[model samples]
Target: MAWQLEGTYFENCNCNMICPCSTSGLTEPATRDRCNVMLAFHVDRGDVNGVDVSGLNVAVVADTPALMSDGGWRMGLLMDSAASQEQADALGAVFGGKLGGPMEGLGPLVGEMLGMESRAITYANDGREHSVQIDDAINVKVEDFVSPLDATGAGVKVSGVGFPADTLAAGHATASTVNIFGLSWDNTGKNSFSAPFAWSA
Candidate 1:
């Protein structure tokens, strides 16, 4: 039951420029620190249990506290409405990390099932701008990079990480407080990335 998916997302977190997680650092955010990332998946061509998932979309809403290993976070999944019951179930299984895909490794850290919904996704990346909004669930914006002399939208890059491997990432993030699986977070600060990523089941 191994499938492949390619997509992008806009993540919001409470950290300084260049989130420590992206560089393999286990540093914690401020006292009220949190990490809430929204992953929007567009299954270019994938399936589960004989289900067709070519044009389907799914999302992963993850929240981590402080050090990200405290393991008291929550998750919520969103599936496209066009999918049939069987297809929806299959999509849920895969995105929920139950089918042993690239995201399965995070399963052990999941706190609870916040439930899944059917919604639309708006994802885009233009040169230095990256953004994605789930209709009304979440809205994230990536600011452009600043110049060294001017110190506008200063940008930085980190090697070896998830998707968008050689990321052209900026040093800023803007997001609103959100409630997913009963957890609330206004992930602000230096936690945003757009890099290349590749993982197998």
Candidate 2:
């Protein structure tokens, strides 16, 4: 079966100012010599197999030991509670790397699946900020970056990170919470960003 998901995604990690995991370039060690990241997505327009999966949300949270390049990543995925069994299965197949797509490109890096949950998920991008909540699993808020030289803040873009997209706006987390995968962190003021995305399998 063929599937495609066009959406927007946001992510935050406990890396220095920027997370090398997103770019697939992590020659140096991160702040903690590891990466703990939470990523969420909103499918404004999508379809899986023959099922319509629009207006749904999904997420993948991970804890990677050593540099992102070193792999050995453990992760958990959250699907939209409202999705049907068919749609849910499709999302899982895609995100789990069982199907081909951008995720499949990273298939070699993932080492474990801690768990999966389908619960109320929310992803919103207001004029000033972006926020995502997956039931009680996590809550994240990303704020845009501003320049000291310029008074009016501009969305910052960083190209060639680990994300599938060509570029992503740089952000800093205002609020971050996690309670799953035996991984826990409150990474406020950490590396954060958002960008549009498209994936197919």
Task: Score each candidate by Cα lDDT.
Answer: 0.62, 0.82
- Across 64-125, the per-residue lDDT of candidate 1 in tens digits comes to 77666667767888887767888888888877778886557667777877888877666666
Q: In angstroms, give how far residue 68 of model 1 lies from its true place.
A: 1.4
On residues 1-201, what C-alpha lDDT tens digit does candidate 2 reach at each position?
A: 888899888888887566655655656666776788888888988888888989888899998886766778898899899899888988888888888887787778888888888889888987558898877878999887876776656656798764567788887899999987788988899988788899886
In model 1, what lDDT does residue 133 have?
A: 66
Best by lDDT: 2
RMSD of each: 3.7, 1.8
Over 4 Å off in model 2, which ranges? 24-28
Model 2 TM = 0.92
Position 23, candidate 2: lDDT:
56
